[model samples]
Target: MLSAILLFGWDFAMRTYFPEDETPANMASREDAPSARADGAIDVGNGSAGIDAPQVVDVDTALASADRIIIDAPEILGSINPVGGRVDDIDLKTHRQTVEEDSGPIRLMSPAGTPGQHFAQFGWVGEGVALPGADTPWQVIAGDQLAQETPVTLGWDNGQGLSFALRFAIDEHYMLTVSQAVRNTGTGSVALRPYAFINRTSANASKSTWNVHSGPIAASGEGVNFDWDYDEVLEEGPVELGNGTDWVGFTDIYWLSALITQEGQGASGAFRSTGGETYRADLIYDPINVGAGQTVTRTTRLFAGAKESAVLSEYANQGVENFNLAIDWGWFRLIAWPMWQVLIFLFGLLGNFGLAIIGLTLIIRLLLFPIAQKQFHSMAQMRAVQPKMKALQERYKEDKPQLQQEMAKLYKEEKVNPLAGCLPIFIQIPIFFALYKVLLLAIEMRHEPFFGWLRDLSAPDPATILNLFGLLPFDPPGFLAIGVLAVLLGFTMWLQFKLNPAAMDPMQQQIFMIMPWVLMFVMAPFAAGLLLYWISNNVLTLAQQKYLYMRNPQLRMQMEKDREEKLRAAEREKADKAQE
Candidate 1:
């Protein structure tokens, strides 16, 4: 019931606060059709907006069919498709599809006709002016190849006295600057609105996790940030933001492509999913009127590459307008961000992410040492009063209230809080989740190798015991994929439980004994780095327990006495059963 209420409340909050525009089906009849008006102003309705529907074809066919210009930046390789002059194909030269050095580069964008058709396009929507369309084959007049030092310029003329020139400049990294210059050479003035869009025809192929966002995300210069899933965009139509310096784009687990502009330079943009596989994130500027023989230019930037933390921070620092918010830090940003920074620092020192995780765990344990000591002392006190507690339980077995009253009185008299042992666990929960977020979201952990049998700390341990660590022929499924680290984690957990004070109830004792193994299976699918941290924590806790037990001699004596009595009782019962 509580879960249902929380879910309902969350739904209500989303609908009320983050309300989206009407669906495309509902708006189709109300809005103008997606085409140019008689005055040459493009009627870019919410859905199916700005341009004609793309034809379905393979990526190779699309690239082969277009007259393409090569893009040869230091970190990126792609082409400028003359068919609409779109920055269609892009591959990150630094990142590979696989860990192998010989693997292909990571492809970020593809031609419009591909299976995963995705591309970034820039053009103009104008009134009584001729603008480039999807079929317009732009003429490359400047450079043959786009590079860091050399820029590429594409030109087109409407023959009615309006000429358009697009100049593209790229940096050594992944930022692209597109400057659009419109010259009015006609007898009359023409009005044009510069626009940029990122279009994706298919959903992301990467596995989507609930915590990791993989869809449309936007941020404004005014500090507003919003994100939506693909289905939400489809159901809610378009998300309209008022004019401000803003950027909107799509983000997968690792890559991002956003269109950015300065403050108050353009009209507020919209992130729209056209009620199908087609999705577009676009920014349209206010109309610019240019008189005859006058030229107007507008510039926008594009960020398309891996979402690295330092790189994103640099861009954000360089006035990119909340660009660092692109990486989904979730609700735990306060904890997760610092944790990530610490991990990066430790990794730089240790040269291994696994070692860095171990280092982080050690630091956290040290910080929580005082609280843990209190919990351990309280547990020892509980152990010392175990006999008295059992006596009270037997005396008040039939009276539940009386038993609770007696327990409370006994706790008060002994100065022991029964809930003290839970404090450490409560504290560890947030740290555990924060570290999980760091491992899952930070790109630094991707493809990082640990010690033997742990090639990827971000992924689950691959070597399964069921396959005898790859010696056996048959492979095991996910449930049966318990590896060496998982087994060690279970063993350490069992040791930690055994070393601590035993529970008073038989059912509780049984549960404590069974939980470690159950969690071994449950945590088998978690990252190996997480399992390593858990194991390290358990070991530290076990050591702490030993020290506490040594210091509390009375508690140790009581536990030993209880153990001896249980053993004697068992032997006596055995002898009696044999005689009978």
Candidate 2:
């Protein structure tokens, strides 16, 4: 019955309270029918071609082969490939590849032709106007290097009447503002549409988990966000978002790459998984008509790098519609956002994330103190009536319905709820999932350290009892990676169970005894921060139970009676052995 209650409560919280957002109406309507060209090719609207088959090359060769313009900023370091005029080679200076301080910076984008080639490409595509393709070699017109203070401009001119120029400006952080302009230096008026696309040769290394979104996500200003898996994008062909303030990009566990546009701009966006391990998130603005001797320019923003909540929120606050939605806060944003804020506050107060988690658990316990007190008082009443309940059970052994009616009547008279014990677990279910989402999606928690042997709180505990906590030379299997924290979690759970009122049925008693150890094994693979939270929660609960039990005379009396009965049984067994 307890297991059923727990499972049902968890399911209810996940399905009802934290439901996945339905695919945006625009996306849903276009899912079955995508636009196609007259030639029977999948028209990825905006003049974007089908996903190109990637040519694999070594990273060193790809970097060395490209004639590049360097990009140097405080937060980002990369270069632009002139061959395609793609901002492709980027490394996030603020983030490392691993937890070690000496670890290399995280490589965010690699140039094309590499094994893990990924890049952002911006260009003009139009009919009868010979625009630059992937093979066009752009000439650096203005700045030699791209920086926060200095913007770089790359220009290319077709033998026809049109000349295109791209001016790139980057902030200190991750956002890049690219402005595309065209000059009709010929006799005839020319029409061209500006388009920006992020292309990747392979999916991210981090596997998409149920809790964290790690693939294509789009948000139309209609207050709805569409999240899709890479496989879904591949199987469903292409996802198109019609005119609105929308952003389309790929989100990994910690990093994000998105194309941003202005509000009410009639731009079209599409996400397509090209064959041979390639995926593209492309956006194209409406065509601009430039008369002879006239110039037209359009601007858009590109966001690439770590998905810092504050940075995303700042962008959202600065008129980027729903930019904060980039961080997958899930459906329970109301609860999860405040919870995350409090956690961040606690982390600021306390330097260590482990301590912050413990602080958060204490705050939750204090907040729910009144409800827990009532629950414990009702439990005490139930414990006091256990003897009467057993007598009633014996009296109505054959009449199950009558026994249930009598028990209900007894509970009413005693002012006790039989299911009141489930209140805490029910209250905790949402919090548990919220914290899980925060730990899984928050970049601040990535590679954040706790005390000894706990290097990365967001990652599973590395030390294992089976390997003597790394003292042994050989490595232990994943299931056997039970660390000290996991053991403490089980111990605290067991302690809380011991403090609770004894179950009436032997089977329930047995289950209660084994449930903690079972959960410890089950949670062995979870993040260390999550295990720390659970352990702290269990300990606090055990403490609360002990304090409540000590203050309640009825509970104290029941515990004393059970203790005396156990002692008497032990004495009787010894006496019987002596007589034998």
lDDT of 1 by residue, 1-580 (tens): 3433553465577778998644322111112333556764345543322333434455677678546888999889989888778888899998888766788899898865455667888878765555776556889889988999999999999999989998999998899999989898878888778888887754443545678888877887566354577777778867776577478888887889889885548656777765347678887888788898999998888898988999999998988878887877888889999999999999999999899998998899889989988887887788878779989989999999999999999999999998998999998988899888888888778888898889888889988999999999997866668888899999999998887666767889988998888788778889888898899889888887788778878777877877788799899999999999
lDDT of each: 0.79, 0.79
**TM-score between model 2 and native:** 0.89
Once fitted onto the true fold, the runs of candidate 1 whose alpha carbons sit more than 4 angstroms away are 1-58, 65-67, 221-227, 274-276, 576-580
Error of 2 at 329 (Å): 2.0
lDDT tens readout by residue for model 2, 494-548:
9888878777687999999989887887787889999999998888888888788
How much is the lDDT of residue 358 in candidate 1? 88
